[model samples]
Target chain A: MYKVKVYITLRESVLDPQGAAVQQSLHSLTYNEVSDVRVGKYVELTIKDTDRDLDQLVKEMCEKLLANTVIEAYRYDVEEVITQ
Target chain B: MYKVKVYITLRESVLDPQGAAVQQSLHSLTYNEVSDVRVGKYVELTIKDTDRDLDQLVKEMCEKLLANTVIEAYRYDVEEVITQ
Candidate 1:
């Protein structure tokens, strides 16, 4: 099996209200030194095969459905997992 | 600085169309053994301070804004980074 890790984040110039809210909460909780907080998403997937061609497949998936390249950016890493 | 990693995934019962599409792509790419694909999100945040109270602050941040606890589930790990 293969494990894929995907990270999605808002475009750098875009304002992240959710992240701002978290920043505010951190300050209120006495973590006043915290100056910024940007929140994003992490997803993990397990696929049943591990072939040389799998990389292209995963990349196509990321482009078509796994990510919205306009508003967000995504990166993924695939690794083979050993089974007992 | 402290680095926070957040993972968000669809609840077990929710159908993940995006993930399904990716799975199909994998099969078409000759990864016929691949049976399932679920997509989620990953976010990373760098906080400016690391005090004993930081744990509580980060948890609150995750609960209120970093994650949608109802439709999604999240877990985070806090680590201190050394500056060169």
Candidate 2:
């Protein structure tokens, strides 16, 4: 099986209100050194053993549903899992 | 400076409704090979240069807010940023 770890984040040009709120919360917590806080999504996908090209399949999945390319960008790491 | 990438996810024992929803969506899209979808949170923390022990600070942050030890688990990657 293949385990794909996907990370999706708002584009640098996009405003991140949730991030801002978290930043403010941090500031209130006295973690003043923290800045440029950006919040994102982390998705883990487990795919059954298949012959399809993993890269193409993951990219298609990201483009079609995992990520909103218009405002967010996504990247992934794939690892093979051995089932005993 | 340090850039910390944090990934927070529900514990294996915990149920993930968002993940199930995404799994169903993927199935509808005909990605039948996909399974075991888990959804999580991705946070990017930009920390200013400091003399404090980074490992300790990050651990505290995760325990205090980033991860709910009761039901969520978190891991992080820290990268040193060379500011020119």
Candidate 3:
């Protein structure tokens, strides 16, 4: 089997209210060393077939459904794995 | 400073089209042993201070801005790091 890891995040210029809130909380927690916080997403998947032309398909998926390209960005990595 | 890593993903019941597409790509690549694929997001943030109660703040951030709690879930980890 193969494993895919995906990462999604807002564009750098975008204001991240969620990150700001986390920063504030870190300040309150006595984790005074924390300065800023930005939040994003991570996902992992296992695929059954690996003989297809998955690169183009995955790219299309990112463009069409996985991400809202206008506001977010996504990247993925593929790895081979042993399945039971 | 403190480093915060955030992970966001769709719930189990949600259809992950991006993941499916990637799976197809893997199959084409000759990685035929692959199975199902799920896609998610990952974010890393560097905070200047870490003495505050960041837990509550991060939770609020996740609820209000970091993730769409209705359809997505988020989790985070914090690490202390030295900054120049």
Best by TM-score: 2
Summarize candidate 2's per-residue lDDT along A1-84 as a digit string, tens digits: 999999999999999999898878877877888877899999999999988899999999999999999999999999999999
Model 2, runs deviating above 4 Å: none
**Candidate 2 C-alpha error for residue A66, in Å:** 1.0
Q: What is the lDDT of candidate 3?
A: 0.69
Error of 1 at B47 (Å): 1.8
Q: What local lDDT does model 2 show for residue A48?
A: 97
The TM-scores that each candidate's chain B achieves against the reference are: 0.84, 0.95, 0.86
User: Deviation in angstroms for B39 in model 3?
Assistant: 6.6
Off by over 4 Å in 3: B1-41, B49-84
Tell me the whole-model lDDT of each prediction, alpha carbons only.
0.72, 0.93, 0.69
lDDT of 3 by residue, B1-84 (tens): 667777888888888898788668766764445567666766576766634576775676567655688888788897878767
Q: In model 1, how large is the Cα lDDT of residue B68?
A: 76
Residue pairs with backbone overlap in model 1:
A41-B41, A41-B42, A41-B43, A42-B41, A42-B42
What count of clashes does model 3 give? 54
> What is the C-alpha lDDT profile of model 1 across A5-80, one tens digit per residue?
8777888888889888877876776667667777776656687864557777667666766567888777788888
